[model samples]
Target: MSRIPEIVFVTREEIIDELWNKGIESAFNSNIYAYTWYLDIVSPGWSALITDNYDYLFPLPTKKKYGINYIIQPLYCQQLGLYSSKHITPELVDTFIDNIPSKFKYVNINLNIHNKTDKHKSDTNSRVTYMLDLLNYDDQIFPKYKENTKRNILKAFAKNHTITTSLTPSEFISFYKYNGHIESPAKEIKIIKQLIECLIRQQKLTLLGCINQSNEIGSVALFAENNDTIYYLLGARNKRIKSSSLHFLLDYQIKNRSGLGKTLDFEGSMIPSIAHFFSGFGAKPCKYLNYTKNSIPASDLILRLKKELGL
Candidate 1:
């Protein structure tokens, strides 16, 4: 049995080895986004809250804006919250929320799917992601795909578009920059490049691409492996192409990885169209919460009073 939970805030540099060991060895929430090296690339200087027994961990990615400290969820980090090998009760979640340092006057963070609490309903917003269980063989899984998804896959095949895994980090970055519809800032793109390099070094990256008959790269995707799950970290495709290369690419992954007891996490889109695209592959929606709080009343009053007093 573990000791009574005593949560403590830890700085980024203070508990690196211990925290990462626990993260890999014991944490029940198996998300790559929570790992030390992954967090370092996307959310540098991030800290955490941990229980005395190291049974629970919560990453606090903070930022200071306009001289006020606040917590903001980092880019490419889909879900992060209480991670534990033990059962996470509502009360435990509340305890962690309550312990967030008061100096952070504002908070905006996303909790993992395993967490649930009624205590802070007013302060939380709902978010959804899609996940596909790949325990069944491809033949068994194919029947469950939406008809449209199947049609797209067939269409790509008929067009002679081939799936390829011979993509480099630099090639994928360039493709994404020019063809992707999403607005990725230069800094975020740079971080993505660095992350790809790191993942490649660890041999944990699955880079896939769809090539057209003309031998042009039309679509590309990057998936990161952590244990048995694969995260669909990022992807980009040419909109001008008539063929659905993304459909072909993801179907290729599902086919090869099926019956392997693995999961594919489509690191998500709340937009209906995008969500539908993911669901087409028979992926199901998983819900999580985003917590937000503002102690603006008290802080604003204090500021005004100080300003009026001229010191």
Candidate 2:
């Protein structure tokens, strides 16, 4: 009989070092969300589970509501789950899932793309992210773009729209909020702003905008890059010239960032319209899992009521 891998909850003091070491060992751990600095900004009191020697790890971004401790998917973070330096097997993933502490009564989080487990497959929800490999730049890239996307890009060019990276975070946020793209509460927006500032200070943020001859900002997007991927974090546009400005802005970004050999992650929307838009740029669908489990009494009932009420 084989011994079960002993998983231990890491203390606050140990998180930074472990996360840094794991990131250096595992490519997927390059995601900024899992880093201590980023977590400190968005999910302040986060912790993790780790096997001895840090071969396998899982970050648990927790919160307390009405005295009930639960895990949640943090804002601006797309995924958080098992991260490993070695090949992850079904048994390994299952072991990690089973070991999550029972103190967390409500758990809802998106696992990283590298994580897969048959143990709780049915309880997982699916979401698709779009990624474009930038190696096929210049000559080979634009040809892959959907015909409609090409047309829109040309239209923006014909209209003499200019692309610029001079927009500040505050300006972009103001534009995003005014365009009704920000539905988050003021507090959440404040957190997002702080995250943006931190990434900017690290020189990991790219802000792009499409402006007309009249100097009007038609569309803007914020792209944050880590070691492996350039994430299309957020975007907003003025309704007046929404037709081709966004298409042009995105194309310009891909073109400029191409040949760098990193993936462009369309940090996504499950909405059909948004998915279709991402597909137009030659990005393919990459699926990930979201897991949820409720252990608290009445939690399931409340969730059922919320679903019924469409809340």
Best by lDDT: 1
Whole-model lDDT per candidate: 0.85, 0.81
Q: Which ten residues in a row have the lowest lDDT in candidate 2?
A: 21-30
72-100 per-residue lDDT for model 2 (tens digits): 99888897787766676667777887888
After superposition, candidate 2 runs with Cα above 4 Å error: 1-4, 11-14, 18-25, 299-311
Stretches of candidate 1 off by over 4 Å are: 1-4, 181-184, 297-311
Each model's backbone clash number: 0, 0
TM-score top scorer: 1
